[model samples]
Target: MNFKQLGLSDDLIKILNKSGIADPTPIQKQSIPQIIDGKDVIAEAATGTGKTLAFLLPLLENINPKSNEIQALILTPTRELAIQITNEANKLKEFNDISILPVYGGKDIASQLKKLNNNIHLIIATPGRLLDHLERKTIDLSKLKTFILDEADQMLLMGFKNEVESIISKMPRKKQILCFSATIDSSVKKLAYRYMKNPIEVFIKQNDIALDAIEQDIVETTDRKKRDALCKVLDEDNPFMAIIFCRTKRRVDELEAVLHTRKYNCEKLHSDIPQNKRERIMKSFRNAEIQYLIATDVAARGLDINGITHIYNYDIPESVESYIHRIGRTGRAGESGYTCMFIDPKNIKDVNEIEDVIGFKIRRRNVEI
Candidate 1:
């Protein structure tokens, strides 16, 4: 249905039309009604399915402009996600004139503290930073009406259970809670059972690798041949943007150095870099200023971007789910993409598991070095 038919304000509808969001996505169509009606919801939808806007729009539509205190709080798993959510929230300028702030670690807390005095309608934050604000009394959640946990599964994976629990305990008892995820891990399910009140569960089809619009292949190789093989593939494909997934920080560093030595526009992302640098790296990558990004799983998890042409698994992932998550970087928003995995003889089972979940065999590409 049209956004106008969804009971959205005229101003919001106009904004959506201008932004080319005329029709609501399935999740939006289903959940917006419940969210606007002030219901706790447990929605399971994959990435790029408009989960952010699904929740943000209703929150913006239901905001109490009369109140100066924080009214809605969104807890995300990563700093990048927190920033992305806050950016999207700012696009609701047609609906309200309230502040939307993003709070996360590795940035200056003083700046965020300065923003606390404003009329913030929505606060999108990471768990650790939110708990910090709660402890310092810098954030007033007593008037909170809606609380959202975006990417609940990712948060649980990052070991934020205690912090998330503490943050939840501080919110008002009468608030409407919403939790959205790609996959509802057991911890997330348990959290919903404990905190949500008669929540409506909405599960869309999980995004599998085979169902994605990405072509997959494996390059069987030895450790010494992997670098040369990757270089050959890069020369052949000449991708506009690509991410090379390494298994360790050393590998990421070495790969970056080697690519730099070869004059490839590349950068490294890992836990070792400070947050500011990471932000800059991502900004460059998003703007197409950098063509290649080398990263580990921890750094690359939850990265949401568009127009990624290729994803190279420099090392085979031990967890089968990770293979899905990695290739998921490409073939987004119904666009066709490609993924190449460098596999050793011993890692055949890992590749097989990925194929089993995706329900298809990845075509093999042989490159004799």
Candidate 2:
């Protein structure tokens, strides 16, 4: 249905039409009305399912344009997601006078402090940085009207549970809470039970974890031959754009170096890189200026790029959930995609676990490396 039917304001409807967002996704259709009605909601939706807009649209609707205080707080697991949400909010608020500030680590805290000192209406932040501000009294969430925990599962996975709880403890008591996550584990449920007041549950079951459009396959190779096997797969597939998932920063650096020396247009993303460079790399990758991006799991989450034709698992992820998230990057927006995993003999157990989680066997293929 349309945004107007979702109880959004006329101005927001006009803005969404101009931005080419005429209809809402399943999650948006289910959760936006409840959220706009000022109810706590717990949503279980996968990545790339238009969830950002699901919470963002209702958030913009509830915001008071006349208030100079921070009326809304959005806590994300990564700086990338905070920035992405902030960018989306800025785009939607182009015709309005609302001010938003994204607070995350790896950037200039002084500049963020200056912005915080201004009449910011919404603050999209990571838990740690928000705690820092709360401790320093740079941010006053006493006036916060709405609180959102985007990617709650990711936050818990990243060891921010205590920090998130602490941040939540500092918000106004009577404010509305909205939580959106890819999966609702026991911990997520406990968090919701503890914080949310009679929350509405919304689950959008799409493909049951693995996208049907993704062609999943595995290439068995030894540790020494994985690089050559990956090269062979790349040559055979000839993807328009791809992300090569490595397990560590060192591996990403080494792999990116090797790929660059081989005259491949590629870049590396990891925690060691500066935030500005990482943002630039993400922008380049989104624009298809870079064909290959070698990244670790921490660096890859919250990447909402479209048109990714391939995903290369240069290293098997540590968990089944991570594998799902990595492959979910591709096969988005109804486009057919491919995922090739170079599995060493040692990580066969991990692959098996992934297969068990996805409830299917991945096609195994041999490449002459």
> Given candidate 1, what's the lDDT at residue 86?
76
TM-score per candidate, in order?
A: 0.93, 0.93
- lDDT at 168, model 1: 79
- Write model 1 residue lDDT over 223-262, tens digit each, in one string: 8889999998888889999999999999999999998999
Runs of candidate 1 with Cα error greater than 4 angstroms are 207-212
Error of 2 at 54 (Å): 1.0
Model 2 C-alpha lDDT per residue in residues 1-369, reported as the tens digit of each score: 778888998988888889777878889999999999999999998787789999999999889888898999999998888888998899888767899999999888999998877799999999888899999999999989999999998899889999998998888889899999988889999988898899999998745544788999999888888888888888888889999999999999989998888888899998789888889998999899999999998788767898899999999988876778889899876688899898878887888888887879999987976
> Model 1: which ten-residue window has the lowest total lDDT?
203-212
lDDT of each: 0.85, 0.88
- Model 1: pairs clashing at backbone N, Cα or C within 3 Å: none
Q: What would the TM-score be for candidate 2 when compared with the true structure? A: 0.93
